[model samples]
Target: MVQAQVTRREFLKASALVAAQVTCGAWLTGCANALAASAPPPAASDAPAPIATPTLSRELPFSGWREVKYYDQLASAVVQCAQCPRRCVIAPNARGFCQTRENRDGKLYSVVYGRPCITKTTPIEKAAIYHMLPGTQSYSLGTAGCNLACLYCQNYTIARAKPEEVESYTMTPDDVVAAALKAKTKSITFSYSEASVAFEWMMDIAKVARAKGLKVILKTGGYINEAPLKELCGALDAINVDMKGFSQTFYDQVCQGELKYVLETIKTIRRENKAWLEVANLVVPGYNDDPKMIGDFCAWFKENLGDDVPVFFTRYEPAYRLRMPPTPVETMERTYKIARDAGLKYAYVGNLPGHTGANTYCPKCGKLLIERVGFDIKQNQIAKGKCKFCGETINGKWA
Candidate 1:
């Protein structure tokens, strides 16, 4: 496993100075004449700003959480959560399947509201969104619990745990926006465990971020109801939906979710046409990595999502309950070929660094557009949302 990287707090001090571009004045605390928020990024030779020690400390653990919307009250003090496809019928003082929302006396409350287990800045590429704002940073945060039960969950330590089961940091919507602004990230992302389980928190932060002229992104399993997803489409700037598998058997036996709901959610997002959309499927060996299944996935994508939306067949790591070895590089290459054979315009193989599969090529001229090493961009040849060489309009949010 890759060693853990430093936290946002335990970061370099000079990094902020380089970010501020204040060569004339510098100090241990911060730099003078900090670059304007609207200032253009520096050249490739210039080092990006190191993470600032976020002075805004985390608040206390979650308690006395607030009530959430999109729930229906039933007889005998029961409530049904309508946020995700689960539509879990919660008993009085009981929690839902995800353990993030609780039903209290016929009212539903999001127990994980304003409480995030992890909050950090990441490259937008890490979200598997290569076409939008390449090389820019995104502020990301996520709480515990997830709607779907993936056996090979990479973040099961938090994802499989209940809200109270894990230590969390309280962060209101204002606090999230403030931290994103402070970090100077291009966008704010709701990621990690599962954003859908923390519906109220994700919506609150996305709305606030949108109002502040900061773009909002969501990395989700696409296991949500239409009403809530439409609301999210209106607020979010970009969304990367995790399409777990192609077959219903795979969805039922492996992910413990329905395949139809995920497909509906993806279609709903595309129908709304409000947010930039991308799809990612974790290729787990002996689960859903069959070549026929991949071909079916590509066919479904072509029919439903067209060729513009980018799709990634990501390398699955050994984690959580699954003891399978890492997905082989040769498997990633086959998936890429499957996508190409399906006439996919922008399909990629993710998670393996320094591979040609990680790069983006123009659909028209077939010239290299973006070269990513892990989550960092090494080269970007798209300008004004078009290929620099052939001037073909790339389908994504370029601004």
Candidate 2:
């Protein structure tokens, strides 16, 4: 379509000067014509201009800084952070438990904004959100730092590193949207490490992405405060919340977070009627793999989030500070059966490729609606979000 309105000759002539200047990083427009003449072939110059690119911006890549747009300074030099449930009253140079935000010199400044250390375009299915949009791709990006210190965190390299310890590129909100457009992704994910930690950047990028009709997904631990979550619900399309465990003991001893707060966050997400919500429980052996506990968890989910809310029991590997053996595949299969018995309609076993339980089955007819092999989708049998066999509508955001 760009070619229909503008001929190659006119387009080339119009863009030659800007292209020459940008290519040479030169501001001397007097030499633009000459530069274009001596430059490479017309085919090179005919290439379309980029939507947005990287820039020079510095943000801390650690759990060591505070960022807030709304806060008040107390007489004791404490800043009241309204960002998360932590609502930390931070003293100068002190950090939150998330270890990313900090109070510096009586004011709060989030240091991870616009400086993402990890950025890539990946399949949306890889985010493990099978029901949201199957086989679509999303632009995934994240900075360092997390609010929760889950000992079994899978991406701890960037998740646990400081700004100086990792490499990052500067980008604005527009750059993120451009990256999504350039990659032909249908959605963008604030993922890899933790989306809540880099809230400001995400808010900005989501605005532009939504304007462009691109979807947004939040791959989170559901450790965020209410206000931010509500603000984010405006632009977010889907969310996958990690339900680490069912008990406070596991939340404190294993994840170093509050179970009640995570539950509250999930409830709020459901109440807001915002975003397609899915829950994931990492089934760690000898930690949270007990059948009774898993059953209780499933029952709670069925009551609170409903039976239609899909739950994923992901097999845990030995990583980070926990060097224990990986969870047995048999255990994951057993848990899947337990969840099924607990009245949950859509329960899945993740991280074990080619497992029969990895595919999505119709809860009513017991027919496979979607087939999977690892992250690859081998087959899809749904028509307009209804089961092909039973004609019952699947409870998910299947677009």
Best-performing candidate as measured by lDDT? 1
**Candidate 2 residues 87-193, lDDT tens each?**
77778888665555677788777777777766666778778688977888787877877777788888888787765466555567887787677667899888878
TM-score of each: 0.85, 0.85
Name model 1 segments beyond 4 Å from true.
Answer: 1-64
RMSD of 1: 8.3
Show pairs that collide, candidate 1: none
lDDT on C-alpha atoms for all candidate structures: 0.81, 0.77
Report the Cα RMSD per candidate. 8.3, 9.7
In angstroms, the error of model 2 at 101 is: 2.2
Give per-residue CA lDDT, model 1, range 275-360, as digits (tens).
99999999988888999999988998999989889999999998877888999889889999999989999998998988888888
